[model samples]
Target chain A: MNSQQIHLASRPTGMPSQANFKTVDVTLPALQEGEVLVKNTWMSVDPYMRGRMIVSDSYIPPFQIDEVLEGGAIGEVIESMNAQFPVGAKVSNISGWRTTFISDGSDLTLLPAVGLPDQHFLGVIGMPGLTGWVGLFKVAQLKPTDTVFVSAASGAVGSVVCQIAKLHGCKVIGSVGSDEKADMVKAMGVDAVINYKKVDDLTQALRDAAPEGIDVYFENVGGAHLEAALNVMNPYGRIPVCGMIADYNAETPQPGPSNLLLINTKKLTLQGYIVMDYWDQYGEFVEQMGQWLKEGKVTSEETVYHGLDQAVDAFIGLFEGKNKGKMLVKI
Target chain B: MNSQQIHLASRPTGMPSQANFKTVDVTLPALQEGEVLVKNTWMSVDPYMRGRMIVSDSYIPPFQIDEVLEGGAIGEVIESMNAQFPVGAKVSNISGWRTTFISDGSDLTLLPAVGLPDQHFLGVIGMPGLTGWVGLFKVAQLKPTDTVFVSAASGAVGSVVCQIAKLHGCKVIGSVGSDEKADMVKAMGVDAVINYKKVDDLTQALRDAAPEGIDVYFENVGGAHLEAALNVMNPYGRIPVCGMIADYNAETPQPGPSNLLLINTKKLTLQGYIVMDYWDQYGEFVEQMGQWLKEGKVTSEETVYHGLDQAVDAFIGLFEGKNKGKMLVKI
Candidate 1:
C-alpha cells in the first residue's frame, strides 16, 4: 500500500495557508532490518515550526517546496520487524504527517504513557510539557519567591510555566489575549492575569499585576509585550524566550525593542530556548516531572483538534490565540 | 588645618561645567578614637561617577548638589589612632577630591603594592581593576576560548577587561574612540579594534571584527555600541555592564537599543555590576591578579592629571576620548 502524506506546495509569505500544502500518496519500500513501521495517530502544531519553514539556517531545517510537511508526531508500531519496537505496540515518533511510516528506530524513543490516549503524546506529557519544564528550570532558573510574568500564559508552554513556578513557590503572573483565558489562568491560582488586549497601558498593567517587579519572565509572545516587561522587570530579571509568537506572522521584523537599554539599567537576561537541543537531560526532567505530576504540583490544559486534516486549522489558530492550551491535531 | 575640596555645585544639564563644582577649604578637626586622617595621594575618576552625579535612586545614592563627589581613591594615613591601619600606611579609601580626610578606618583597606607606582593602585590595583575582574568572572562567568567584545576599550575598566580576558585564553575585540587607543588595545593583544568613529557601519564592523561571533561583551559604553554587539553576539553570550559612558553626558536619557529583541533571539545574558557590591570576593581576585601581574600576563597604563586643578579637565577629556587608559588626578 502507498503511504498518504501532506507536502509543502508553496513557501508561506506570511501565514501558511491551505495553498501551501498538497496531500498526495507515495509508495513506500519495505522496512529494513532494523526499521519499524509506524501509523501516525497524532501531530503537534507549534509556532517554532514557522521558523523552520523559512529558508534560514535556524534550529531546524527549512521546508522545501513540494515536500512532505514534517514535524513531531505520535504513532503506533503497526508493522515492526525489530525487537526494540514489536508489531502492534504503541509508540510515538517524529514521522511527521504520514498515515504509515517505516523507521530504523534509532531516533525513535518510547513514550512513558503507553496506556494513555495518543493525543496526550502531543500534549502535556510530550514536547510542550518538556519545553515548558526545561525552559523554566534551565533558562529561567527560577527562585521560589520570584515574581514571574508570562506572555501567552494561556498557551501550552506558558500554562505549564505558571503551574511549575507556582509549584516552586513563585508568585506567578500571566498575560493572555482574552478575558476568558485570563480568567482561566487566574482560576489556576496564578497570582494575576493581564488581558493584554484590554489593557490600555501595557506597562501599567504589568506593574499592577506584578507589584514587586517581575524577577522571571517566561517570554513567548514578543513585540509590545516584551517592551512592557522591560519596563516592569526588576533588577537582574531573567527572560526565557520559548517563542516569539507575535513576530512569527510579521512579513518583516518589527523595529526591535525601543527600550532595550533597560537591559543595562535593570540588568536583565533574555534567553531563547529550543527544547530539542536539550533532550540529553530528558530522563532527569521526566523523573522530576513525574514526581510533580504524582504530587499534584503541576497540571496542564489542552486544545485538541480531531482528525489529521484539521492540522492546518489548529496550527493557524495558534497565531489567532484561539487555542486554550496546547494546540494539537489528533490523527 | 584647612582641607581643599571640590563639591558638586549644581546638577549638570548635559556636560558638566566649571560652575558645577565649588572648591572650598574647611578646617578639619583632629582625629578621634579609632579614626585616622588620610591625605589624598591619587584620586580615581570613573564613568559610574557620572551616573551617581544624577539625582536618582539606584543601587547607590546619587550625588547631591553642593556635596563633595566621592569615589574609589588611594591615600596615605597621615595620622592614625586605629591599630588596623597605622600612620604612614597607604590605604585604598573613598577620598572625595580633598587634600585631607577623616575616616574611622573600618571600611579602609590597605593598598597592596611593593615599589609599584602608587597610582597603579587607582588604575589596575584599585576599584577599576576590581570592577573588570568581578564583572568578567563572577557576573559574566566568561570561559576560556570565548570571544569577547569591549566598548570604550581604552577606559579604566575596558582597557583592563581586554588584558584580563586575553590572560584567560580568550580572543578579544575592542572598540575605541581614537586610532591611538585602538592601536594601544591591539598592541595589548586584542585581536581586533574597531574605530567606531570612522566606521561606516557599526554592526558590520563588529561582525568583521568578531567573525566567529562574540561570546562575552564588556559594556562600558552603551547605545550604538550595544546595538552593534547585539547584532553579532553568539547565542548565550554574556554581557557584563560596568558603565554607559556614551550616554553619561546626554541632556535627556537616549533612545535605547532598537534591536534588543536580539537578546531573546541570541539568548544573551546581560548583567550590570557595581564593583564594591562584590568586594567580599576581592581578596581572592587580588591574589590571582597579583600572580598575573607578577608573571607579566597583564600590564598597566594611566592618563594622569598633575594636580587637583586639572580634575575638571581630566574628567571632561574622558568624554572627548582625550585620555587613554585610567584618567586620574595626582594630588
Candidate 2:
C-alpha cells in the first residue's frame, strides 16, 4: 500500500512557507505480528509544532530534516494482528501528517465509545483539552473568586480554559484577534471579550474589561499580551504559561515583557508547562470533560482543511490567526 | 529630647543623590501609655529601598516626598512606658533612617539573646536572613541533589542562600562582580564562583561553571544575569526572584531577556516574592538560623558606615555595589 506524508524540507525562518515542507509518497510494508494498520481520518496542526522545526534543546527533540513529521491523529484499524485493537475500530495515535501507517498497537489508544464525532477526539477531548485542564486547574491553581484572563481566547486550549473558568464560577475575560473570534468566545459564557486588533492599547482595554484586576492569567500569546496581563494583575496573581504563539515564528529572538519587574512587585507566579507532564491524570480529565460535553456545557469547535495536500496550509494558517478554533486536516 | 531623621526631599528619577534627601532634627513627644522609646543603633540600607523612592503601586506603598523613610533597624529601648519591654531591652523595628523614634510597641520585635551583636539583627538574624531562608527552602524547594545558581552571591541575602544551600548538601554556583566578592562567596562552600565583571560572556561563564545545568536560580540580580541563568537552567527549574538590584537605578524601563521562550521549552517556574509574605514562619526560620549560627555553619558579614550622616551614602552605595555583605549605618 502507498502512504502520502509531509516531510520537513528545511527549518523555517520566521513565518513558515510551503517550500519548507515536501509531500512524499512511500510504500507501506505488510503488518508484522502485534501490528495494526491505521488510515488517518483527522490530524492536528498545533502551534507547538513550530518549536520542533528548529534545532535546539527543548522538552521534545527537534524534527530531523527530510523525516516525516508526527503529531496527534485519529485513525481506524483497517487490519490488525493484535487482539487489543480490532479491525474497523477507531483509535488515536501520534502518526499524524500522514494518510496511512502501521502502528505496533502499543502507541495506539482505543477511542472512547462516546457519541461525539471522531474528529472531536483530536481536539476538545484530546491533547489540547487536557492541556487547558492541567494548566488552568493544576498549574494556575484557579479559585472560584479568581478573575481570569486568557489570551488567544478562541483557540483550542484557550476556549477550553475560558469555558472551564466560567463553569467553575470565575469571571472570565478573553482576548481575541478578530470580531468573529470575540463573538465565539463570548458565546462560551466569557464575562467580557476584547477584540485585541481593534484596541488601541491592550493594557487599557484589559483594565477596562477587568476592572477588578486579574488574579489568574492563562498565557497563550506572549509579547504584548503578557505585558498587558502583567499590568492588570492583582497581588499574588498566578500565570500559567501554556504557549507563546505570537513569537513562535519570529526570525530572531524577541524581547520579553519590559515590566517583568511586576512579577516581583506584584508577587506573581509564572509557570510554564506541557500537557505530556500530566498524562497520568488523563483518565480523570476525560471523565469530567465528557460529562461537561454530555450536559451541553462545553463544545468542540474546529476549522478543518479537506485533504492531506492542504495540511501545510492548515498548519501555516495557525500563525496567521486564520483559524477560529482547533486547526485540523481531514485526510 | 530630639530625634534626627532622614526625609525624602524629592523623588529620584534614577540613581538617587544626596540632594534628594534631607536630615531634619525634630523634638520627640512624651511617650503615651503602651509606648516605648527606641534609640536606633544600626540601620539597614537595602536595594529594595530604591522601589520606595518612586511613586508607584507596589507591594508596599512608595515613600512620600518630604517624609521620613522607613526600613529595618535595630535599636536599644533606652526608656519604656510599656511593662512588656524593659528599659535596656534590644529590639528590631521598621523605623530605620532615623536616630530615634517613639514606638507604640506595635512594630517592635524583641531581639533574641543569642550572644550575637545587636547589629546582627539588621542583617543575618533579621529580614535579609529570613528572606534568603524563605526563598531557598519554601519558594525554590531546593533538593540536596540539585545544582543551585545564585546571582549577587556575596551580598546580604545571596550569601545566606549560598550557605543554606551548601549546608543542605547541594552544589552551589555563585556570580559576583569582583574577585573579592567571588572569594567571599567561594569561602561559603560554594562549588564554583564566577567573577562576572571579568568574563566576556556571562552565559558562557555560567555554562562552564555549571556543565550539568542549574535546577534552582536564586535571582537577586536581573538583566543579563537572569538571561544567563535561563540559558543554563535545567528542565523544570525554579527561579526564586528575591530582588533585581541591577535595574534598581534605571531611569527608564529596561528590556527583559530575549530568550524568555526557554521558560516554556524547559518548563521553568519563575516566582517573585517578598519576605513579608512568610512572616508567619519567621519563628521557625529564626530557630533554625540561630542553631546554624551557633554551630558555626553560618556567619554574619556587614559593611558598616558610622553615624546617621552616612545613611544616605550607604543607601546610594547599594546601587553602585559598594557594600560587601549587608550595608548598614551605625547611628
Candidate 3:
C-alpha cells in the first residue's frame, strides 16, 4: 500500500508559494504491535501554521525541510493492532498534510459521534472554536454588557468569537475584508459590520460604529485593525491578541499602534495567547460548544478544497482573505 | 492671609516652559465650618503630571488653562475648625504648587510620625511607594524567583520598584540615563544596572545584563527601554506600565515598539495601571513598607528644591533627569 504526503521543501522569505512544498509517495510498512494505520479525511489550514513555516524559534518549532508538515486532521482507523484503536473508529490527530498515516495512538483523540459532521471536529468543535471561547471569556474577560469589536469576524476563530459574545449578551461590532463576509458576520448577529476594504480610515469607521467606545477588542488582524481598536477603546478596555495574520508574511516588521500610550491613559490591557496553552479547558469547551450546536444557537462554516494537492493553495488563500470561515482540505 | 499659587497659563506645544505658568498672590477667605489652613512644606513633581498639562480627557481631567496646578503635597495644619484635624498635625494633601492654602479638611490624610522623616511619607510611604508595591505584587504578579527589569530605576516610582523586588528575593536589573543614577539604583541592591546613556544598543545591553530572560518589566520610560524589555522577556511575562516619560514631551506621536508581535509569540501581558485605582490596598502597603523602613530593609531618598520660585524648574528638571529619587520642591 502507498500513501501520499506533503513536505516543506524550503522556508519562505515573504509570502509563501507552492514552490516551498513538495509531494512524495511513500510505501507503507507493516504496522508495529501498538501502531494503527489510519486514513485521513479532512485537514485544517490555519494562519498560525505560517509562523511554523519560518526557520526560527517561535511559540512552536518551525517546520523542518523535507519533513511532513503537520496540523489538525480527522481520520478513520482502517487497520489497528492496539485494543484502544479499533478499526472503523474516527479520531482527531495532528499528523496532517498526509492522506494516510500510522500512529502510535498517543497523538490521536477519539471523536465521539454526536450526529454532526466529522470534519467539524477540525473547526467549530475543535481548535478554532476553543480559541474563540478562551480569548473572549478568559483572556478578554468579556462582560455581559461589553461592547466588543472583533477583527476578521467572518473567519473561523473570529466567527465563533462574535457568536459567543452575542450569546453572552454583549454588543458586538465586527470588521471584515468584503461585503460578502460582512453579510455572513451580520447573520451571526453582530451589531455592526465594517467592510474594511471600503473604509478610508478604520479608526473613523470604528468610531462611527461604536459611538460609546469598545470595552473589549478581539484582535486577529494586527496592523491597522489594532490601531483602530486602540483609538476607540474605553477605559480599562481589554485586547486579547489571538493572531496577527496581517503581518505574518511581512518582509519587514510592521509598525505597532502609535497610540499605545493610551494603554496607560485608558488603563488598557493587551494580552497575547495561543490556544494550545489552554488545553486544560478543552472538555468544558467541547461541552458548551456542543450544547450551542444542538440548540442551533451558533452556526459553523468552512471553505473546502477536495484533495491534498490543494493544501498549499488552501493555506495561501487564508492570507488573501479568500476563506469565509475555516479553510480545510478534504482528502 | 495671602497664598501664592502657580497656574497653568498656557498649554505647551512639546516640552513645557516656565512661560507656560503664572504665579499669582491671592488673599484667601476665612475658613468655613470644618475647614483648615494647610501650610505646604513639600510638594511632589511627577511625570504623570505631564499628561495632565495637555488639554485632553485622560484617566484624570487635564489641568485647565489658568487654573492652579495641584498634585501630591505634604503640609502642616496651621489652623483647624475641624476636630479631626488639629493644629500642627502633618497631612498629605493634593493642593500643591502653592506655599499655603485654606482647605475644607475633606482632602487631607493625617500622617503618622512612624519615627521616620515626615517627607518619607511623600515618597516611600506615600503615593510613589504605594505605586511601587501595587505594581510589583498586584499588577505584574511578581514571584519570588522572578527576574525584574526596571526602567528609570533611579526615579521616584522605579527606585522603590527595584528595592521592593530586591526585598522579595528576585533578580533585578535596572536602567538609568547616567552612571550617577546607575550607582544610585545599584545602592538599592539591584543585581545589575545598565547606564543607557553609555550603551549604543539598549537591547543588547539588556540582553547582556539579564542573560536569562526577564519575568517582569516595570515600565516608566517607555521608548527604547520598553523595546529592550520586550526583546528579552521570557514567555508568559508581565509588563505593568506606569508612565511613558520618554515621549511625554513629544509634539508628534512616537511610534510604539515595532516588535510588538512578540506580545503574541511570547504570550506576554502588558497592563497599564495608576496608583489611584489601587487606593483600597493602601493600608496593607503602608504597613509593610513602614516595617521595611523601620528594619532598614528599604531606604528612601529625595532631591529637594528650596522654594516656590523653583517649582517650575524642579518640574522641568525631571525631564532632564536631574533628580536621583523623589523630586520635591520644599516650599
Candidate 4:
C-alpha cells in the first residue's frame, strides 16, 4: 500500500481552486518488467503548470483529467527490477504527483551526486538553473558591462539571474513586490532593488536604479513592470523573455504593450524563448553552471514547502509574492 | 543660383499639420573647393520621418524649426567641382528637402549601378530593403520551412520580406488593409494574404491561413494584427519589428495584445530594429538584392508622387493604406 497520491480533477478557469485538485490514498500498482517504484521526495510547483491545466493547443499538452500532474521532481527508487536503476537509487524524473509511482525505465534518470540535497536538483542545479543561464547568457547575449533588470526579482530564475550577473561583472537591478524581498534580492548581490508595490511611478524608480538604461531584461513578471522597463531600456537592448508569472493566473492577460512599437524606435531585441527548446545545449550549459557553482561564481536560494497537501498553497504564494526564492513543495 | 526647399515649420504632437511645414526657395551658398551641388531628383517619404519629427533623443536630431527637413534622396549631380563625383553622376545622400544642395564632399556617396532602376535604390536597394533583410535574416534568424506572417504585405519593406521568405522556401502569409493590396501581395508569390481591415477575426484568419503556426512575424502594422499573430504563434516564433504604421498618426497609440505574456509561454522572439544601425552591412545587402533583381527572382512596385508639393499627401497615404508600394516624391 502507498502512503499518498494526487491527481488532476478539473481544468482551471483563471487561478486554480482546491476543487480542481483531487488528493487520494491509493494502493501502489505492481511493478511490471523493466519497471520500478519511485517514492517521490520532492515536487515542483511552477507558473508553467498553470498553462498545462488549460485545453489550449500549445507546444506542450494540457494535463489530462484524472491523471497525476507531472513536472521535474526527485525521488527514491524503493523497488527496481531494471539494473540501470537498482533499488535504493536516488533518481530524478517528471513523475506525477504521487507518493509512490510505478513506471517503466523511461521517466527516471539516476541522480548523480551523493551528498547534495535532492531538492536542489529540482531547483538550482536543475531546470530553473538552466532557464536563467540560457535566457541571460545565450539568448540575451549577456556582456560584461550590460545592465540587467529582472521582474519578480526574488523568484528562482530571477534570483539566479542576479547572482549570475554579479559573476559576469554586470550591473543588476530587480523589481519585487515587497521591502523584504527587495532586501533578500539585495543580499543576492543585485546592485539595486525596487519595491514595485510601494512605488507610484515605476518608470521614475527604474530611472533612479539604472541611470544608463538596462541592456538585458530577464522578464519573469510582466505587466506594468514591463511597461516601466521598456521606458528605461537603452538602444540595442536585448530582452530575453523566460516567463510572465504576473498573468499566469490572470482571468484575461493584459492585451499587449501600448509602446511595443518602441521596440523598433529604440532598436530593442525582445526575444521570447522556452528553455527546453535549447535542450541540445544542456550539456554545455550544465558544464558552465556547474563550474560557476564550484568557483563560487553563482549561488542559489529556495522557499521550500513541507508536503504534497501544501502544493496548492505553494502555488498561490507566487501570485502574492510570498516566496523568497523558488516556491517549492516537498513530499 | 537658388534652390526651392520645404523647411520644418514646427514639431508635431501626433501627425504633422500643414502649418508644421514652410516651403521656400533660397539662394545657394557658393560651393567651396572639392564641393558639389546635386539636383535632388527623388526624396524618400517614409513613416519614420513622422516619428523623427517629434522624438527628442534618437539617432538623428529633430529638424530645427524653419530648417529644411532632412532625409534620404537619390539625386543627379548637375554641377560638381569634386573629383569623386563628376557632373551627371547619380548619388544617394541625406541632403534635406531641397532641390539643390552644396556639399563639401563629406557625406554623399556615389550610387553604383547594380543594374536596377534608380527608384529601386529607394525601395529594394535602400534602407527599406536593408531593414527587411537584417530584421528577417540577421535579427530574426529565420530558417527554411519556417512559416512567416508579415503585416503591411504590399508595402516597401514588407513586399521585399515576402520575396525573401519565398526565396528561402518559407511558407509566407501576409496581412494587408484591402483586397486589392491582398491581391497585390499574392502576385508577389506570398502563399496567403488576409486583408486585416476586412477581417475582424484576425487570429482565426491567421490560423486558417497558416494552420501549422507562425514562426516569423515581420511586424509592420502593430495593433490588432500583432494581437492576432501572437495568438497562433508557435513556440520560439520570431517577430522582427520594422514598422508600426497603424498608430503613427494617432494622438496616443492604443494598447494592443495586452496578452504579451504569451511571448513567454509560447517563447516568441520580437526584435525591433531601425535599419541605419545595420549600415555596415549595406554593401552586402545591395549586392544580394541586386542579384535577386537581375535574376528575376524579386521585383518591386513604386508609387511615384510627381513633385515635392505632393509629399505631404503621399506621407498621409501610408496611414490610409493608399499607396501600392514604396511612396516616393519625384522632384
Runs of candidate 2 exceeding 4 Å displacement:
none
- Per-model TM-score, in order, reads 0.91, 0.98, 0.98, 0.95
lDDT per model vs. reference: 0.81, 0.92, 0.91, 0.83
lDDT of 3 by residue, A1-331 (tens): 6999999999987899999999999989999999999999999999999999986658899999999899999999999998898999899999899999999999999996677788888889899999999999989988998999999999999999999999999999999999999999999988999999999999999999999999999999888898889989999999998988878999987777777788888899999999999989999998899989989998897899999999999998999998998889999
Q: Per model, how much of the real contact set is kept?
A: 0.41, 0.80, 0.81, 0.85
Q: Write the per-residue lDDT of candidate 3 for residues B1-331, one digit (tens) a residue.
A: 8999999999888888999999999889999889999999999998889999987758888999988998999999999998899999898999999989988888999997578888888898889999999999999998999999999999999899999999999999999999999989988889999999999999999889888999999999887888889999999999998888888999988877777778899999999999999999999988899999999999997999999989999999999999999998999
**Top DockQ model:** 2
lDDT of 2 by residue, B4-121 (tens): 9999999988899999999999999998989989999999999889898897888889999889999999999999999988899898999999999999888999898888888878
Which runs of model 3 end up more than 4 angstroms from their true locations? Answer: none
Candidate ranking under DockQ, highest first, comes to 2, 3, 4, 1
Q: Residue by residue across A1-331, what tens digits does model 1's lDDT show?
A: 5788888787787877888787789999977888888888778888877776778635457888887877788878878789999877677677666677788887677778534456655666678888888888888888898998888999988888888888889999999999989888987889988898998999998888777898988888877888899888888888887777777777765555556556666767777667877888878877777677666666657788887678778877888898998888877
Clashing residue pairs in candidate 1, if any?
A36-A103
What are the per-residue Cα lDDT tens digits for candidate 4 across B72-146? 888888788899999999999887478888987688888877767777888888988888899889888889989
Task: Report the Cα lDDT for residue A25, model 2.
Answer: 100
Which lDDT tens digits does candidate 1 get at residues B142-250?
Answer: 8997999999888888888999998899999999988899889988998899999999999999888888899998888888888888888888788887777777788
Evaluated on CA atoms against the true complex, candidate 2 attains a DockQ of 0.83
- Alpha-carbon interface RMSD for all candidates, in angstroms: 3.1, 0.9, 1.0, 1.7
Error of 2 at A12 (Å): 1.0
